[model samples]
Target: MKTWLTRCLLGGLLVTSPALAQDDDAPYAYPEDEPARDEQQEAEEDAYERRRRQVDETDDFRRVSEEEGEEGDFKELAGVDDPNIGFAVELIGGALLLDSSEGNFAKTVAGLGLRATWEYGRTFNLEPLRENLWADLRWTYGSYSDGTDFIRGDTGVHYFTVAPAYELKLGKTSLGIFGQLGGGIGYQTTSITIDAAETKVNGIKPVFQYGVGLRGRPRLSNKLSLSFRVEAMGFRRGYLNDIFLGGSIGTAF
Candidate 1:
């Protein structure tokens, strides 16, 4: 009986020891001690303030990141601080390939023209690709003197076109050259000169053209800035038109 009692007492002590330890470790004071209670309350309040400050700091960091993203990290990487919108005027030249078929031999006619482009800022908030959109307007003239055709005359055209273009910036580099694509409609007319004296004029017609090319502009201040591009243009109609591999260079504003 004594042995069983002793064993019971030992088991009870083991079970109660942890609870006793926990109670001893906790802060203890008389209920009448208001100063001790106030101190504990103040400590809790200080901890809460610390937590709130941490949250505010985190939120501030997030806001800064979003603002930086809108400003474009690409500009920083490329070292280009140009405005979102820009304008450029170019002196352009290219070959005019007259499709002289039906027992007529063909030749490449090189010509010159003026081109203007507008960078219309990023219409979309999406980064990179949308940022490179541009509007291109051009008026050009080309002449081809053909001795191989039945006409045996000079063929020429006056083309005015407006096209929307997009640039794909390959890398973030100052003065970087990148690929661009554009296509749009225009008005064109044919001018034919025979034997250096007689001239034939064709009526105005609608023309379609698309081009792929490399384009680039330097980072410059309010002074005259230089820009350049090279492209191969294709025409859907108006064989009297020009599909030329050409390049342009001029000032950008």
Candidate 2:
């Protein structure tokens, strides 16, 4: 009876083992899906690679823009023949002396002047003229104050000048030479007491004169400069024979 029971148990185990083996084989039925899984994985990897390349391209473009900005080449401008043009102002200061005084006596004169200059050249020539010639018209108004005994009085004078100029450039500096020929009328008033009354030296004296001058300019830019000028004028009338001298420091723009 024990032997028969053992054989029955062995038979039951053999039947169950075959069913388990069949179930394991059933899981391998769809072999075709393996290739699809592999393809999906490869597609995902390709998409990741494309995204990385796009990010890299954006970074490269940004870097190039930053470098261009740092170089500052975009700030440079072009197309002008010369950057300098238009009107300017100058302030003049210097001494005055009567030309006919004959070295017998001298009086001290101090005065101020206002002037305007124009340029016609298109190039920044060390010499700023055409064939070394430039033309300018200026008006000068000034007063003389005296502290000496020879002629103790205050005098005012007005004159206009037409100057044709020339220039010489040395390195960054420019030296100008010019002469003017023009005339204007003037009057003389005096503070001397004649018979207990202050009197005028002369009434509406007519003044006529010519002058010569020198100037210099230092470049501050292609368009701007620092300017200096000195000029001397001589009168025509023997009595009004006076030497008018002046200096100006200002800007040319």
Candidate 3:
């Protein structure tokens, strides 16, 4: 009986020893906090996403503002509050068709003139004839050379006028067709060359002017413009009529 009990005890000891060795040789496992780490990483990603979205939104707003600015949503963007009030200088070169009543001296003459104008835009509505009513104060100087054989002569006229004008705008653009009527007083001087001798006539006269013109600002720039005009001018004491066809390149401010 003692020998059988010893063998049984030895077999039990051997089985338990193998199980203990297997447990000791197994790899060590630390407590996992993966859920906490995952929550922290997810929170950081959400914050970064929110910040990126805000930046994108700000950029979008800025882009929209710039677009509005370009479309002329702001009145002061170009420092022009009144589009109609401006100043211009014109160079006029053309032929002056003098009245035939003065005989051969009244023939078509080559002429040049300079004009400085201050324009007041849209003072009233003359809806019957035009869309808008405007006015201009203009100073003008002109010189004419007669080509007729009766006498080689030159004439100079200087004047100032207040012109009430009408403009018909083309759609919403900066182009318009305009007409003006003006009257003023001026001095006239004429020099006639005959037999190598020069004789001059000087006098003061009442002047009247009427014109039709096409005016435009290129690329919508209000500070500059070009104009083409045809004018019929008369002097009470000098000539019956002088017709002028010319164009002007000018700047406005």
The best candidate in terms of lDDT: 1
lDDT of all the models against the reference?
Answer: 0.66, 0.61, 0.63
- On TM-score, the stronger of 2 and 3 is 3
The best-first sequence of candidates by lDDT reads 1, 3, 2
Question: What's each prediction's TM-score?
Answer: 0.56, 0.50, 0.53
Question: What stretches of model 2 exceed 4 Å from their correct place?
Answer: 1-80, 100-103, 120-132, 135-154, 166-172, 191-208, 237-239
- Root-mean-square deviation of each candidate, in angstroms? 17.2, 14.7, 11.0
Residue 60 in candidate 3 has what lDDT?
86
lDDT of 2 by residue, 34-122 (tens): 65458888999999999999999999866654453456744222223556664456887777665434465544466556777676443
Candidate order by decreasing TM-score: 1, 3, 2
Q: Which tens-of-lDDT digit does each residue in 37-153 have in candidate 1?
A: 588889999999999999999998667555545556622222134353567899989886755645365467776788898876444434564447777887766666555443466
**Among all windows of ten consecutive residues in candidate 3, which has the lowest summed lDDT?**
122-131
- Which 10-residue window of candidate 1 scores lowest in summed lDDT? 74-83
**lDDT for predicted candidate 2 compared with the true structure:** 0.61
